[model samples]
Target chain A: MDFSGLINDFGPLTVSGLAQGAIIALFALGYTLVYGVLRLINFAHSEVFLMGTYACLFVWGLFGLDQNSAAPSVGLMLLYLVIGLVGAIIASGATALAVELVAYRPLRRRNAPPLAFLITAIGASLFISELTGVLTHRNQKGVPPVIQAKPLFTIGDTTVTNLQLLIIVLALVMMFLLDRFINGSRLGRGIRAVAQNPDSAALMGVNKSRVIGLVFLLGGLMAGVAAVMYNLKIGVTRYDAGFLLGIDAFAAAVLGGIGNLRGALLGGLLLGVLQAYAAGLFGSQWLHAASFVLLVVILLFRPTGLLGESLGRARA
Target chain B: MSVSEKATFRSSGGVRGWFGRQPVWVRGVVVAVALVLAFLLPYAGDIPLLGPQIVTEGIDWPSALFNMSYYVLLALGLNVVVGYAGLLDLGYVGFFAVGAYGTALLTSPDSVLYADTGWKWLMAVPVALALTMVAGLILGWPTLRLRGDYLAIVTLGFAEIIRIFATSTTTLRGDRGFASIPHPPGEWGGKPIFGVTDAVPYFWLGLVVIILVILGVRNLDRSRVGRSWLAIREDEEAAEIMGVRTIKYKLWAFAIGAFIGGLGGVLFAGEQGFINSQTFVLQFSILVLAGVVMGGSGNMAGAILGGALISYIPDRLRGISLGDTDLYEYRFALFGAVIIIIMVLRPQGLIPSRRRAMELKDREKEVAPQ
Candidate 1:
């Protein structure tokens, strides 16, 4: 109804969308990578991400950081971020590995059907989230806000939170590193080989289990980083937070093409931006609905994903 | 020899044959016994023959019967899509919601949604089915081409969208939901049948629907349509090469499944006396799926049995107390444990379908089958 206000408000919406997209994109990488290698949708990946958030919140609480307290110097904050990132990665990586071992490896060993795996995934997902709920005592835990950059820039009409900019930047840095790792490193080569043809990869002396473990660890690592960044942005974390966010990330993965790494990044950003635009045009309530509507539309026409390969070869 | 001759040979009566060899009276006796047992369950459940601690809390026959029949319909509907056609429709509840609300929209005494049109009770059946079928088509058309995880993602997205729309829309009264949906027209057996009045009518209604659905699906499974569907599920490319229109069969499966789901939705709505989005969450979809899995895929009897088990398990658990401790806190954990145990011990389900048994067994053989 008001064009001027809409125009002025669009700036904040775009920035916020970018930040949200960045976090989703970060989580999407783990999903895309695991799907690429194993062709199994890791339903527990979201829980892995949730574990990261809780790890950060726990660390923050342990440090007794408060919202009103002045942020420690940037160097100290960076050190803390590094430690938090590592802890989150280890915790999430171990959790992912444990799930795979307990729930998945046995099924695979028995040569269980894909449906069996899907069922197991669902069970593991519910168990993880419910366990988290019980462990956290069903309470929302707050993450002491990370303040790195001063709120120094104003683009057009909205005040931007410094934490938002840092999250986006941090996500980008981690993504770049991940891209390099996947596209450049020797382990990445093994991963690609396994994804291309597991039997052949094994024939060629690629350790199948090791490669699978590495993929889970890498994916878990990304989810962990995403958790810290997400906590920093949202200020609070809960066990069920992963459920909605996981669905959104899963949608993004599908939107981009389920197994394509670049697709995950693009899809996450696109979904986030789309949600922000939808909220700006309509309202916040329409956010989830709009994302799904967009997802259905995209999937119907471009089922392989935006950057996905042809359907025949995408089966891996 | 043609396929039809082979099928006939397989179905013919003899000591060597698997199908028609079983006597008709065996099935009749089984059905008769089951009917007697079901009716007699209330007497058995309420009365303790031996001692106070010797017996456990038993399911209320009326409620148990009602739930069993309701879920039987739900599971059968899902089986047509997921088990027979191999389409993982996470948005199955969308059709259910559509049917429930479709009936509610037409039959509601409360204000809103359709202000101009007068209340139409009987018309809601076909209308709900048609609306849900259309919704199924709209959903299935796009996602049919996608397989495996992609199909799952799209369907899940659709389900969430439906939920969000249901929750956010002002016309549907959002979270509060529409209450006091009018009862179905005419009383069963010359008495009021709506709104929890004597579970007998509802139980019979559900039983009749289940019979019809089971027969319909069983016949369909024997038809050319079912063959095409199975072919598609086995291998899309192979099925396509065999001249089966994969897309057409998939869409048909979806529509038929949704139509059945709509039927179940209407029956359920009539029983509840009110319907809302809360009644059709994603977890309900999972519950239906679990029933389908538990009953054994591609088996009508299995689906019904699974449905009955799933529907009754919660109520059965509700009455049990351990040393003055309740099971509410550990309900979900127990639920997860049940699924995992079933999958591990009885991978093929309580009553494995013929095809599913073969498929799973063949795989077992490949991995050193006993």
Candidate 2:
């Protein structure tokens, strides 16, 4: 229906989509990593991301930076960004650990049925989100203008903004670091072992509990970064913001092969771009519906996903 | 007998055992009496202890009971899928929406398909039920083969799609919804019995539907189909290897569950006389699910109690206050905390199925190695 409009705005839409996709890729790593090792969906992980978004806002608020404030100078902006990122990372990591300890560990010890774990995860998720909702009066909090979206470059009809470049570059750097950490590090081997087979990993003298905790922490850190980038781009955060985005990120993880790291990256980018295109074609109201249709279709046709669930395989 | 066996025997030796020992005629009479008492529950506000405790302060007592009826219906239907069949359907509300929408389209004057006079509520019921069952098959056919979590996400996606479609489509009228969805046809001495002012008739109607659903579900739980569901839930691969047609039973579970859930929706629309996309939020599905899990997922009595409590607690909290804030404001948060606590303390739920309880005990035994 809007072919000509889509063609006209193709460059700009794709650029924006890529920026969103980069953030989604970062957000998706949390789901992929946890699902890889625990084989649980970690429903509370959305609340973990949500906590990061609010934590960063709280930190920025401490520095007297309200939504109406002007962007700071280069040095101060960098300092503020660092402070926000640290606050978010710490908050998200602690929340993830707490969720695991409170909602999951007891069930694990009890050897509770899989349904129990899912239900508890949902409970934990609801508890945090509803608590936040009550505290915030369900209002959307606006982010301070820390870094203004100045055009850094222009190509065709697209003008790449500084914020978008920062988000994309930062996400890539984090992904590269995570990839190396999992592939080249000793701890990464323990993660792979546990993912392949938890019992075998425990038999091989791996501290299964420690590894699981570490996995959660790492995922939380990634979600934290994604949270900050999301604030910078979207400029507002709400208590239930994570609910919809979390679905998209989870779909991305499953789309790329749920247990595979690299696959998450691929899936997130593809999904983001596809969503942008779909929005262009079908109007913005059908944006989420389009993504869901794609998810169902892919699951039906290729349940193993594009990368074939490599985290549980020997190669990963 | 082993220690666990003694405990199980003791647990089953109380009211349930007494009821089991009665003759079939005695059981039938007891059920009839209970049903009669339930029909009189609209006047429960006149009672001393039961009325003051259970009746909602903000909303009328009949309305709350009506709410409980539909919620109980949803829980029982969900119990079939999640409890008996071991399928985690996060999108059970989708069927409810379908049923309501189906009825709305057939009966509401605002609907494009409506004729000179729209269909009666009774006429729309069977169509709504059939549509929901078909919807279930559509959703389940491709996704049931997935692992549990995957199936969950897919079902979640399915509901989200339904909601998004409802919200975005102009034909469904989005949030404006359809109005004048005809109430169930009835007259009592020159007055409409199912009028908007009194929700008691709706409650009775819901009660009747629930009884029918209970009888149907109970029979299914005793048949070969129910046995296959049990086998699948306990172990899918073993059941498949044992020559149980796992897929067929799972689909059957889904279809039946959808039928019951759709029945809830049809009754809901008829009572409300209006419906919109807002009525079918994902949270509604989750609330029903929480009710089932908390009540006793695999037990009919448990599902009924759980469903009633979930609706009742929120309504009961209405107009009550804690210190500075209204208790209703914190109801969902409190419910969430309660869910976490219950799962931690009693993962088998408040009134677990006997077999499920035994299974949990067996699993604990393996873990503890006493």
Candidate 3:
């Protein structure tokens, strides 16, 4: 209904969109990895991310950074950031592993139906999110002013902030390493083999269960990074924050082709830009709706995703 | 929920063995007794011995009945999709919302449609059902092509989209909510069909509607359509190869499910006499799904009981004190635990269908060495 906003604020919108996209792209990797190997949705993956968010915040709190505290010096900030990342990655990866062990492994061993896994996953998710809600008292916890937004430079009339550049650069670097790990490593090959054909992979001596665990671990690690980036960008976190973003990341995963890693990256960026444009066109309240609509459209047009190649599958 | 003796062939020494060996009439008596207890339950909460444990004393019996019946209806509706058809519909509440909004728009005085062209609550039910069925078709058209988790996410998105539209739109009035919705008007003898605090009539109304739906669904389940759904659920590709119209049956399942879900929504709107976007949360859908799965996914009886228990548990916990806080506050946490534990212990559910139960336990039929 409104084209003027998009026209007038195109540059700023693009910058913010790309920055947000980086976080989403990073998060979407988990869904893609898990889906590629297990063919299960891991509905509690949001809790994995949730644990990371709170873990980082708890670490920052231990460092005595409250909302009232001023931003730290560059050296001190980098130290806190590294500490938070470590806290986040550990918490998130552990939660993911626990979910796999407690919720998924038993069902997998029993050869339970897909719906059983979905239902159990939902239960575990509810349990974790509700536990967090009760602990947090359902309040929005503001992150300390860790990475203040300062314009680093202008690119083609777009004011690019240092924070945005940091997010984008960090996301890209992590993704590159992940891509290499998943593609070039032995563990990654095991994951790919299992994804392509689980029975055959097992026949070839690949450890199916181990590979599955590794997939969850990698996904969790990416989600942990995404959580920190999200905190830096949004400046707020809540018990249900992971859920809201998880939906977006899931949409991105689907948009990119669920099992394809690169597609996830592409999907995340596309979704972020689309949402920014949508916010410009409509009010921000409809942002989620816009992403969902885009997802539906993409799904309708290309059900397998933009790049339909799964990790080890022969592309059709 | 108890295992009957004859039904416990795997364990022939315990209480089940004796119960199973009893004559046919013995089982009939058990059913008869259960029926009697169920019929008497709404009144039994006032009894001295059973009052407090059975229910919180002085609580509204009819309201409790209404709540249970409503959830049962939702669970039954969801069962058609998730249990019978095996579709993971995470956004089933979207259909409920559609039904409610359709009813509200047509019947509520706050609606523009009501102001321009008013319709009574009774007249809105059919319209609501049709609208909800159409909504289901629209969602399923693209999504039914995808299987399992993909379908789950799309349906979820559909619900969120519906909510966002409701939230952002000026016509729906968002949080202000549509209120003063007219209830179904009529009288029995000289008495009104509906009255404040008299939830019995509404409960009875819901019961009647549920029975009709159950009857209809049972017939469908026995018919070719039901067979098609079963085939689809077991294996979609295999079913398709067997000449079953997979997409057609899936769409049919979706529409029928939506119709039933819509009926629940209509009843809710009529009973509540008001509706806002708040009532259509995704958790409500999950709760109903849990009920269906908890009771026994494919079994109609299990679905009904499971649905009733889901609502009944929370209401029963109300007014009961635990330390300083109310026990009801922990209802969801308990519910989550129950789901995980139940799924792990009894994946086939409380009143599992013999076929499904056998299939789940089929793991023991390992191949001998060739």
Best of the candidates, lDDT? 2
lDDT of 2 by residue, B1-370 (tens): 2467545555577677677667799999998999899999999889987778767998888999999999999999999999999899989999999999999999999998897548999999998899999999999899876877778778888999999888988888889999999999989999999998988889999999999999999999988999999999989999999999999999999999999999999999999989999988888888888888887788999899989988988888888887889988888888778888988888888888878887888988877321
Q: Which stretches of candidate 2 lie over 4 Å from their true place?
A: A314-316, B1-14, B368-370
Per-candidate TM equals 0.90, 0.95, 0.93
Best of the candidates, TM-score: 2
Q: Name the better of 2 and 3 by TM-score.
A: 2
| Model 3 chain A: lowest-lDDT 10 consecutive positions | A307-316
* Displacement of the residue A179 alpha carbon in candidate 2, Å: 2.4
Each prediction's Cα lDDT score?
Answer: 0.77, 0.89, 0.85
How big a share of the true inter-chain contacts is recovered in candidate 2? 0.57
DockQ of each model vs. true complex? 0.46, 0.61, 0.52
Decreasing lDDT order of the candidates: 2, 3, 1
lDDT of 3 at B213: 90
Question: Can you give the lDDT of residue A163 in candidate 2?
Answer: 94
- Candidate 1 regions exceeding 4 Å error are A1-6, A66-76, A134-137, A148-150, A155-160, A309-316, B1-21, B35-61, B111-121, B185-191, B195-200, B319-325, B365-370
Q: Which candidate is the best by DockQ?
A: 2
Model 2, A9-81: lDDT tens per residue? 8988888888889889989999999999988888888899999999999999999999999999999999999
Worst 10 residues of 3 chain B by lDDT: B1-10
